[model samples]
Target: MSFTEPMGRQRADDYRSAMVSSDPLMDVAAGLDAEVAQYFLVSARCGCFMQAARSLNVRPTQLRKHLALLEEQLQRTLFRFQGSALTLSRDGQLFHAQLIAMAHERKLPVIEQPLIRLAVAQSILHDILGRDLVALLRRNASVRLEIISLDSDLSLQAVSADVVVWLASTESPLPGPSFAVSEPERLAPLEYLPHIAKRYSRVTARPVSLDDLADFLLVQWQHERPVESFRPWHDIVDQRLAGVVQLHSYELMLEMIRCSACIGLLPGYMGRFDRGLIALPGLFDQSMQRQVWMAVKRESAGCEQTRMIVDLIRNTFHERREWFDT
Candidate 1:
């Protein structure tokens, strides 16, 4: 219709109808929600509402609502329902492809991630969690990691870590100023330290007794070695009186133990994984083993970053269960 046409009711109605159908900005004005798109994709991947909800750590009802709202906005049914089964419709597949393409093309808006403050000793960080932690940081661009290097005697509350990983024994357990603690994940034992000599053919046989261990210097990770704190195997150390050699990190201690005839307290996981190290038959009592504890402040227990880190830690432990039993 030309603008020079006479003003009439039929002409106005036609103009309004054309504007509504042809407007390029209508879809843009409706607002594309990334979260809704994520929900749809997760549900499709999981192939069920319940499983998708569990995967995304959200309520199934919430996911349903997101899918319903997304369908309403797009004016299309995205899922085909057959009794209890759920499958993506043709339109849903197309939408999924579009959303994934947008993300791959870097067209999606970036979401901010919460900063995570983690406190752990340098030794534990180096020997066990170093690789996993590095991978988490590299994979997650949103997260800002503020790692607090803690000393053995440093108080947990003093550092105020959102999450803290500490080495604790069954006898000592986790200290006061309570945080939600994960199940004790046992470290690989230092029993294998004495066997390093045998593995390297430096010794004819494994050390048979505590007296035999006295022939070698007792090396300990500087961050975890007990000074004033009570060690579980009090008699093992007190009776033998092996001179202690403290190293700054487990890697250095392992290197020292491997190179020389030194007996160090090495993590069981580390010992088991390295073919060059072996566990002495009668040196260590399993009851005296130490464990790795992941603790989080009660206040930040629900924080996304804290939860993600905790899950990653648990998953890492699960993957290395042969070495780091939970």
Candidate 2:
């Protein structure tokens, strides 16, 4: 393909002028093969003909022939061999710089957006992080963020995510260096409080005490796999209570509490988002609180995008600390 085909005639003339007059070899800029120039650029960037060939989806021999044609056209040696390593020659470096500048001037695609994958606990994602993540996407177009809702018992090491947000009890906190995770940051405390829908409260007498919950249907969120350290409703309600319903999804549990005459435990912060939910008074205590931790994989901790996301989450939690307070 000819690089000038998509560019306006004046822009193509400007591109040629930018490359010409600077170097004797660039004098032939008017006759440069765009495809051959691209092949040379990729080969220079990869520093290996085979790697560049794979990136361009072309055979190694074909990539070599294309670069050879570019060198013949420009009358300059574009690459040199040092031991087993392939490197751009002095002439090649100059051409590479000019090509980069031309691509920028023409507004051509040069780099791919960095992708950062975030794995979050189901409840935290729905109740808190989802909005912040959406705002981040709108604010930054250079980065690609993937939000994965974790609904099962998958460990941090098992999931292929750059960042992880999960609920951790005091007894079984986030794993250490062995899990290939950086030092975890405690984002916020989740104070679980009993809540009943406003409509449900009007239909039935508000629970005055924890024991009063036994009279109403209880909707509880149960993990797909048993987590011994996390028991949100440990002594608050009996699982053997007659009308108790267990569910694996936090969303379903919230919906059940809102639509039926069922009472369930939710984080204190949830009351701010769902005004329809009324927290039962005098039922919450310090024992019901759990910690929310955020950590990045050790390998991804240095990424700027990952750090940016970490800061956004940290700031959101800090700003909403009051909502999580009992």
Candidate 3:
């Protein structure tokens, strides 16, 4: 049987992490007693067997036989007919819920591709830009890209990404030389209190330190640029903040910043692109800037596909060097 959804649970060790796990739909269908489950589907939808049989294009006798088979498997009667109306027993409601959930489980979507084995976040494949990048990467090439969904930073570092884009600074990955875009390490501290959202427009003519960022409400990415936990500032964020709201994307954060939701730490390129995000002087120093980097195992980095991807991403972001270097 062909089913579309990736199986098990996101990042689970069981059937999900396994490169291929039979066919997810087939696996799920194999678990249930088909005759009974189908009966439950029709019975739960239509009250009477005769009406359901007509609606489903099956004979009432046939439908009843399916139900009988299911009842035998579960050793429980789903419904009992009283003089005229069909009534669902307590067992029936519970079984009905399971059947619906099973139906939903059957709907997981997974598309098949040939050879490329990629270990990355699901969001990468789903993001607007990410989608474009993927389409570009998969064009008639010598290799196939296997797309895998990674759930956390540990998974990212533990496994391997031919080219990595992350916010955190760490010892260069296996093959050494790495470059960071909009380097997080170089933010120039503002000498004067930075003009944050309009609400903070009058924050203080006096300067506020970066360490004081916690004082203002901050709207941040629910998924931050993956940073290694060892970085001091990674955890420097105010632990006691009353105004941290996590959002789904950077675009939304910029929107919130425009509304003065709070002061935001935005990328130089992204900040300049969004008119709403104007950087004030105090949050970052003149020398402060975040860096984007690309690193890969020596052998993997030599692959033409991976090299092209690295060059495309690096050159694309490299054009924005003035934002950070300036």
The candidate maximizing TM-score is 2
Ten consecutive residues with minimal summed lDDT in candidate 1?
186-195
Residue-level lDDT of model 1, residues 100-145, one tens digit each, is 5457766666556678888875556775677898876554433678
Question: Where does model 3 exceed 4 Å of error?
Answer: 1-152, 170-216, 220-241, 246-255, 284-290
Question: Would you list the C-alpha lDDT of every candidate in the order shown?
Answer: 0.62, 0.73, 0.50
Candidate 1, clashing residue pairs?
A: 188-267, 188-268, 188-269, 189-268
List TM-scores for all candidates, in order. Answer: 0.55, 0.63, 0.41
User: Cα lDDT of model 2 overall?
Assistant: 0.73
Ranking by TM-score: 2, 1, 3
lDDT ranking of the models: 2, 1, 3
Highest-scoring model, lDDT: 2
User: Per model, how many backbone clashes are there?
Assistant: 4, 0, 34
Error of 3 at 43 (Å): 50
In model 2, what lDDT does residue 33 have?
A: 68
